[model samples]
Target: MADSFSQAARAATNELRQLFEPTPLQRNDHLSAQYGAEIWLKREDLTPVRSYKLRGAFTAMAAVLAQRSDQKVFVCASAGNHAQGVAFACRHFGVTGVIFMPVTTPEQKIAKTRIFGGDNIEIRLVGDYFDDTLAASQGYCAEAGGHFLAPFDDADVILGQASVGVEILDQLGKEPDIVILPVGGGGLSAGLTRLFRETGAASSFRYVEPFGGASLTAALAHGAPETLESVDSFVDGAAVARIGALPFETLKNVAMEHVILSKEDSLCATMIDMLNVEGIVLEPAGALAINALEQIKDQVKGKTVICVTSGGNFDFERLPEVKERAQRFLGRKKYFILRLPQRPGALRDFLGLLGPHDDIARFEYLKKSARNFGSVLIGIETTSPDAFEALFSRLDNAGFVYRDITNDDTVAQFII
Candidate 1:
């Protein structure tokens, strides 16, 4: 069964060459040295759509058109990468497509989708949330009798995604020691795992998902796909609330210990590291696999590892926020709410307490809680994480009262 599936996946991949050539699989010395392993990156980020999503979208659309030449319309709902994939496929096939996206999606993404689809697709700005957008798209597809292209759950889509595994084997010329995959709804991970297993590959696998969106972890624990109570949208590309039903069918046997949940803030640091040290720009979801490496560094030592750099559709507009999150995670930056005496030279005294390497990024006087004291919110950035210890010591010695609010999500959201 696995052999037959691998053959089908290979055929699908051969067909995909008409759309775009295989994305590069390159060895990375930077990560290799950092982790004491031979690290190779399957650069899906280099795809025409800057993601592996294009492979699945194109494969599913082509399979439908091949079986039913009369099928002239397709529909899908996506806020980012998938939308672009479908749009690109629609244009290539000369089929009419309707894509529904959340109203809050960035304009940059919307424009890119429009460009990819050209006149072959129509864009619908729907509800503020993804679930609402997906419902609207499905309803419209049913009414119009157009084929709805699922982003990951469909069999054809999964088969399309299996091509990634095929390429990894072909490009590397051998099975790797371990394959680290970043999981969203599990199309990519499931497809690759199935293909590799069927082909008799000896490669082990590690799955990575955002800590705030550990749908796979939840599903494995519940013995089925389970919807998360809440999801953090920070890693927009991989922040899925539930794993796809079809994908989970293939991945259900995966051991819990093999799955690694990456903190969203730590992922930001990975993104920054990749950008600064390796000159690779990765969105939060794209950085998931690389981020998981730190957690398993001991195991990967002296081993041949493949980390799929999933996507590179990062918006430069989010760079500042990414840097701030990265700094906080690295302990080189912090936020504090200070109660200071509302007397002359008090501000100067507080400023004197800061070390030479410390810089105030933000300072705001909230309000006077008492006649003699005022509440102040301050954000400090320092050259080293250790600088905070000395700065805090000085505050203690000066009789200052302060509350660290850097990790206080509720307080930081409102004020920071």
Candidate 2:
């Protein structure tokens, strides 16, 4: 069964070649050397839509249109890379599309989706959140009698996403010892896993999810789809509250030990690493697979491992925040609430104790506590991690009362 499924996927991928060239299977020297393993990236980030979402959209749409020629209208709701994939695929198929996005989506993404679809699609700015936006799109789809394309959850969509796996096998000329995949709504991972199993490749598998949104891992543990109480939306691409039903059905049997949770800040560090070292821009979700390597280093060393850097639809406006997160993760930067003497020479004395490389980035007087002291919030950036240690030690020696707020989510969200 696995061999036949793999064979069918190959045929599908071959047919897809007419649509676009194969995404690269580039061996990354920096990552390989860092991990002491043959680390190859499937480079799904280089696809036409800068994501693997396009492969599934194209395959599913083609199969559907071939059967129902009159199904000319398609609808989908997405606030990120998936919308662009559907828009691009809509234009490719010459079908009319309605894309609904949350009002909170950045103008840059909105513009890019419009540019990709051109005259073949319409953009709808719906609710403030994704769930509401999706509800609106579903209503519109029912009223207009169009097919609602799920980003994941559908078997056909999963089969369509399987094209990535098919291409990976073809491009590499051999099977990898392990494959690390990033999980979002689960379409890509489900499709790839099914195809690999069908191909008789029990390649060791590792699944990465954002620390704030480990839906796939959660589902596998519970042996069912489970909704998270709350999800952090930092890695917007993979910030799903729940795994897709069909996806969980296929993935639930995988061992919990193989699923890894990537902290958002740590993912930022990898994003910075890829951009600086490889000149490759990756969205947070795209960095998940690579970030998992540090945790699995001992197991992957000297093995042929492939990490699927999922998507590159990164918005530059978020670059500053990414950098800040990276710095925090690396421990070279910090924020704090400091209690200092209000006397004129007190501020000067505090400044004099700082290391030469320590620079104050932000300093705001929060409140006046007493006649002799004031509360201040300060953010510090340093050239080296040890600079912070030196600066903090000096502050302690000087008897300055301070609370480190760098990782304080509640305060950082409002002030940082």
Candidate 3:
């Protein structure tokens, strides 16, 4: 089975050359130095569609076309990389493709998908959420008799994603000591796991998932795939509520300890660092594996590690939010509610308590809680994380009442 799978992967990879060359597997010096390990990145972000989704989309579409040469239409629902992948594949195959995306999807993504598909694909703005868009697309496919292309669930899609593992082994010329992969719906991780196991590679694996969308972790816990009650969509590319059934079949044996749940905000710091330091732009999902290194640096030190930076379809519009989240995660920024006296100089007194390096980023006055007191939302930015301690001490010494709501998600959602 291993040999056969390897052969199939090689074949798919060879066919993929018709679309684009193999994504780079470059050794990263900065990351290597930072982690005290030899760190290499499989640059899937450099793909034509800026993601690995194209590999699976093209392979799955090719397989369908091979079986049904008369097939004229393909259908998929995606707001991001998958939509772009399918659109590109449709144009290459000269087939009519219907790409369904949520109505709330960013115009940038929608426009990019349209540009990829050209005249061969039609963009359908359907539901407000992905689930609704998915259901609508399936119904449209069934009604139109068009082939439905799943993002990660199908066997062919898994086979296509396995090609990444093939490329990794071939490019590295030797097995890595460790491979850290970002997990979304499990297709990429499952495919690579199967390929490595089949090839008998000695490398161990660590799977990284966004903390809010930890379907793989949940699956490992429940002994089967389970839908998350709620998923944070910040890591939009990898925020899958449920792991794919087909992929889970291949990944069911993975140990719970091998999985790492990365905080969503921490990923912003990784993204910002890669962009500013390495000049690499990455989406939140793409930063998962790299961000996870901080959690396992002790174990990976002195070893050859490969981290797959998954996608780079980032919208610059979100840069401010990313910076904010990154600062919050690093403790360089904070938000708090202060109970201030309504009397004169109260604001001045509060401002005077701040450290010299502290800068107010936001100061909004909420309604008055009493005749002499009022609630003020304040956001502070500082040069160092430790500055907050001194500032808090000063606030305490001044007999000021305050609530640190920086990490309070409920209050943050409402105010921050």
Q: Pick the candidate with the highest lDDT.
A: 1
lDDT of 1 by residue, 1-416 (tens): 35488999999999999988888899999999999999999998988889999999999999899999999999999999999999999999999999999999999999999999999999999999999999999999999999999988999999999999999999999989999999999999999999999999999999999999999999999999999999999999999999999999999999999999999999999999999998998988899999999999999999999999999999999999999999999999999999999999999999999999999999998996678999999999998988999999999999999999999999999999
User: What TM-score, to 2 decimals, does candidate 1 have?
Assistant: 0.98
List the lowest-lDDT window of 10 residues for candidate 1: 1-10
Q: Using TM-score as the measure, what is the rank order of every candidate, best first? A: 1, 3, 2
- Candidate 2: give the clashing pairs: 2-198
Model 1 pairs whose backbones collide: none
* TM-score of each model, in listed order: 0.98, 0.97, 0.98
Deviation (Å) of 137 in candidate 2: 0.9
Global lDDT of each candidate: 0.95, 0.90, 0.94
Which stretches in model 1 have alpha-carbon errors above 4 Å?
A: 1-3
Deviating ranges (above 4 Å) for candidate 3: 1-3, 368-370
Question: What is the lDDT, from 0 to 100, of the residue 353 in candidate 1?
Answer: 91
**Which is better, 2 or 3, measured by TM-score?**
3
Better of 1 and 2 by TM-score: 1
- Model 3 deviation from native, Cα RMSD in Å: 1.3
